[model samples]
Target: MADELIFYTNPMSRGRIARWMLEETGVPYKTEIMTFGGTMKSPEYLAVNPMGKVPAVRHGKTVVTECAAICAYLADAFPEADLAPTPDERGSYYRWMFFTAGPLEAAATNKALGFETPPDKARMAGYGRFADVMNTLEHAVSTTPYVAGDRFTAADVYVGSHIGWGLGFGTIEKRQAFVDYLGRVTDRPAHKRAVAIDDEAMKIAQ
Candidate 1:
């Protein structure tokens, strides 16, 4: 194998992010679908990702997990796609990318679980509060077409997916800025192709 990319995922999981990134890269890769509570937790698969998560990829001897990381990795790996930032843009690109991965994810999950942060304890929360996180995100996207700056980058791939999914599932409250940002980033042919593939797979699985 001369550094082939092997994608392990389930259609319904965060693997959708990686799928979108892969499609954006226009990369050819083999996909292995694993069912929850079965092959996903099996010893063989656990060896690949101890977390038993979907959206794990093996590129040659390298194995990468986490949706945001995979998106950033693919962008850097496929520079011709222009999904990565130049050195000058790296700060903004990385800022929002990690913000979504850490604070945004935590805030959304906490809200979904109905875990409210007491006022006094808000300072201790990494996301401060879901409302604050949402406000900050809305502001970031409102300032630019993409998360990082004037152009679309890997940061948009990661952050946009979360916002889009959050809006679709009602995990994140509706905001005009979010709606507009999601529309702009997700209008690409790559995103549509990825959605079509996953939608078909989801229908089949159902």
Candidate 2:
């Protein structure tokens, strides 16, 4: 089958995360840039992903959508890249990956909307209220050099993207741990290449 990876993305959107992950893994992927009211929501795109979102991937006939799932999927599919955890690393891998997707993004979005979860049932909330989630994230990032121990696995692509976006948008508190972490990750040669290419494209489009 060629094992070619195809990506549907809008350079201006969250699909940028997938781009960076692709760069990190040193894997080649074809990009089909879509527009807001354009192919993203089309029936053709919807066949691959009912949600019709950016950051969907095609590997032959199998399609993968959702950024977290995409990151995990590609990591396994490209075993030579070693972007995923070993069997023993599953616990921390899934924990931090889903933490970025569920709690971190939820808290950041809630912060952006200026809505606060009620204190009474904060624990019941997946994000566990903003302060709790944010502080917990700060602690989590501080303790681990990477999300899953010393290895930089697919979890970093998920979690580091959160830290990068949160810091950029002022959604997260921009604590020192986040700042340092973002700095370390962004300094990576692959990340810089992806960011430079994407940033230049955005400037041209503007």
Winner by TM-score: 1
Worst 10 residues of 1 by lDDT: 197-206
lDDT of 1 by residue, 101-191 (tens): 9999998988889898898999999999888999999987998778888998888999999999899878898999999999999999999
The candidate maximizing lDDT is 1
lDDT (Cα) of model 2: 0.82
TM-score of each: 0.96, 0.93
Candidate 1 colliding pairs: none
lDDT, candidate 2, 1-206, per-residue tens: 57778888877888888888888888777878777777878999888888877878898888988889988988888889888878887888898789888888888998899888889989778888788787888776777788777867878888898898888889998788888877766777878888887787676431
- Candidate 1 TM-score versus the reference: 0.96
lDDT of 1 at 126: 90
